[model samples]
Target: MDLERLYREDHTFFKVIVGDFNAKIGPRRTAEERHFGTHGVEWNEQGERLSKFIMTTHTIHGNSQFQKPSHLRWTWESPGGQFHLPDRRRCCSEVLHGIGPSSPPR
Candidate 1:
């Protein structure tokens, strides 16, 4: 029904999501804030509950299962103010981090 409910009820372990979500969330400590066009709305008490759910639910681990366990990789591509569609590959996220412009040029 809500973000807090979804993050709390449906998540068990390492629920990694990869997609184009145009909305931003909190605990606002992530890196997606430095850019422009980011819609930082009030998740409010519901958002806070959900944030807590995410923090408490996630389990940080260190194992030999994979190499390069980084959260993000830096690309030379700039944010916002662009030209073509086929050349684009990424979007802004609440958890995502970068110091660039907001939305690309249309």
Candidate 2:
């Protein structure tokens, strides 16, 4: 993806990409601690791909950076109330300063 290429070629500026990736990203794993947090739902095939992209590009997963109430964590819910989809945000760690559950808005 262009974003991946940008991450690989540039290091002069902080990068932050936020959107609904439609990937679960599941919970945090030992190897992905830097990029993921422990408040995710479940991992799936798409989540695996997204995880690989984040690792290879050396980006942080913003959705997992802070703890949130269950209601606030998920971005989408099924009409029947059977499923919830979490959004994903990929950013460089440098861009994450002062951004957290308690951090002031920039």
Candidate 3:
């Protein structure tokens, strides 16, 4: 399956995902409680898909709910003038427990 190729069971237990996710964590963590919170723009389809991806793979979205300034969270400005956080760093087990609902290391 396409998803199978996204992860590997080779000797590594930790993974750092970085790329153009083209998704937003959004401002509603109700359905995606652990991986998101109330911040950023409104949630969209990609965010919903990403929520499932993270949950299914035991991964945590880099947009932890620890509370940081909005400016630091965005990486680019949309042509429509919306700040877009199109990239993120997702992590999996062996190191997930130590994250403590905090933003990724600076």
Candidate 4:
């Protein structure tokens, strides 16, 4: 069976979806008051498609769920020195919401 078929059969078995989709997810706040802040985010064609898929499947953008600086957020730097985050991690809301940075030392 194809990966999608297997994935559907055992969705819980999936910890993450890893790949370089060359997709850009632009910033937006409160998707139906659900999604969080995405720094410098932009919605491209790929992002539109991904957003629709996320809405349908209740998937969360793993990277967006975190608080990272602009430099660390990108996966690639173009020859012209433009940075873009192409790699992505997709997981269900339950899994994504459960992750956050631990408290700092006093």
Pick by lDDT: which candidate is best? 2
| Candidates ranked, most accurate by TM-score first | 2, 3, 4, 1
TM-score of 3: 0.53
Candidate 1 runs further than 4 Å off: 1-27, 30-39, 59-106
Q: Give the top-scoring candidate (TM-score).
A: 2
Tens digit of lDDT per residue, candidate 4, span 1-106? 5534554677484557666666677666565624434663666787677666556555567756667776776655588987766554653345344345784543
- lDDT tens per residue, model 3, 1-106: 3553667543478887766767776665466466655555656687778777777777767665566876676656578876755444653335444465575774
- The total number of steric clashes, by the backbone 3 Å criterion, in model 4 comes to 4
lDDT of 3 at 28: 56
Q: Which digits, one per residue and each the tens of the lDDT, describe model 1 over residues 1-106?
A: 6644675677466565333332234224555322211233334564444345445655211111224334442224446856466534465445645545885554
Write down the worst ten-residue block by lDDT for model 1. Answer: 59-68
Q: How far is candidate 1 from the true structure (C-alpha RMSD, Å)?
A: 17.1
Per-model TM against the reference = 0.24, 0.59, 0.53, 0.52
lDDT of every predicted structure (CA atoms): 0.41, 0.76, 0.65, 0.60
Query: What is the alpha-carbon lDDT for the whole of candidate 4?
Result: 0.60
The residue pairs in collision within model 2 are none
Rank by lDDT, highest first: 2, 3, 4, 1
